[model samples]
Target: MKVSIIMGAYNTAPTLPVSIESILQQTYKDWELIICDDCSKDNTYEVALSYAKNYSNIRVIRNEKNSRLAYSLNHCLQYAQGEYVARMDADDFCLPDRLAKQVAFLDTHPEFAVVGGGVMLFDGKVVKKTIFNPEEPKKEFLARGVPFFHPTIMMRKSVYDILEGYWVSDRTKRGQDYDMWFRFYAKGFRGYNLQEPLLRYHDSLSDYAKKSSWDMTWGATKTIWLGFRVCKMPLRFYPWVLKPIVSWLLPKKLIYIIHNKKHNGKEN
Candidate 1:
């Protein structure tokens, strides 16, 4: 199966090498990498261009101006020629077998629209956390938003065509992954999580854990309300009640510990 990887990069030169190396070392060979630069102020575009020159499968493009991430991603989608499209973040690294396994799953199960694996979170050094979601029916995704990590996703291009790609909502800029997932769910598509950590996501200590809490509070609340209530799912208050409390009470380290234990079946 031919898979296309879409990565939207900003100023990620520090960790971009790791991300590129992950794809270069992938066990699957029939894949292409499409990285779109959103006019990064750093040498990100040059680095990507350098890699593209060396690897036939890697292609790099730069935006005319400093558009946001969603616009950059939509730009990348236009260049994809693969049957399946995979999403990646500039600073995140994929496991060597990530593409091979997801491709096998999709080839075997043609009915499923998208497959994503568990995500491992790191602060550039140690493993800080993990995230997972089981194979969920369409209704659950529609009601609660995305059931899997966005970067770990592999979806058929046909699915994108059917869904008309991502919604260009202001919500998308604030929190677009969930918005797109909900729309896909509403279209009667199903989601599956591989139950293994196939990608490592990098997050800054202050930005991901602390600053984003206050910054995204209003947006996250609005997303949940629209996803759960407006979508009309028979719901519980636990997820709504616990997310903010846990975000406030627990340190990022503790959350990672719990996530690792739950997903790996052992403490890290």
Candidate 2:
């Protein structure tokens, strides 16, 4: 399948090369890399241009004015010319077989519009944890707010064109991916999560505090609120009940342990 990989960047020079190299090493070669810069003050545009000049399949675009992440992604979309659209971030790396595996899964299961594989969180060099939600129907996935990581997802261009692309939400300035997935689920679309780790998600230590506490909270709240609304569940369940349990009763480390054990058992 021909795929258009879109990557939006803003001062991500430090990790941009790694992200690009990961794509270059992909087992699937029938793909185009679209990298667009959101008026970054750094040399992001220059780096992108250099790659574009070197690679025929790599296309680069830059905004004259700052447009942030959402707008930058839209800019990349305008240049996309593929049967499928895949999202990639400038700071994350995909496994060599990521595209091939996701494409194969989607081809075999034509009923599912979106397909994503497992993701491994990293702190630069060390692997911290893995995330994988069991494959389920659209309703269950949406109700649980268990999204297949955006970076690991491969979606048909038809899905985006049908959904009219990402939701430009005021609260989702940084959480647009989640918002989009929620909308897809609301529309009775199906999604799947492959069990093998196919992306190296960088949970860099430098931005942990802000990303986890502020950005993630804003995104998660938006997601859960929409899920509850769509599923007709009482909103109180999140804050009054589940939030407390997730925050205190269930520690993250413990959850990680349980998840790892389950995954290991499956492998055995």
Give the poorly placed runs of model 1, Cα more than 4 Å off: 141-145, 209-215, 235-268
Clash pairs of candidate 2? none
Task: Give lDDT tens digits, candidate 2, residues 180-212.
Answer: 776777777888878888888876535433444
Give me the runs in candidate 2 sitting further than 4 Å from their true place.
Answer: 137-144, 212-223, 231-268
- The local distance difference test score of each candidate is 0.77, 0.75
For each candidate, what TM-score against the reference? 0.83, 0.83
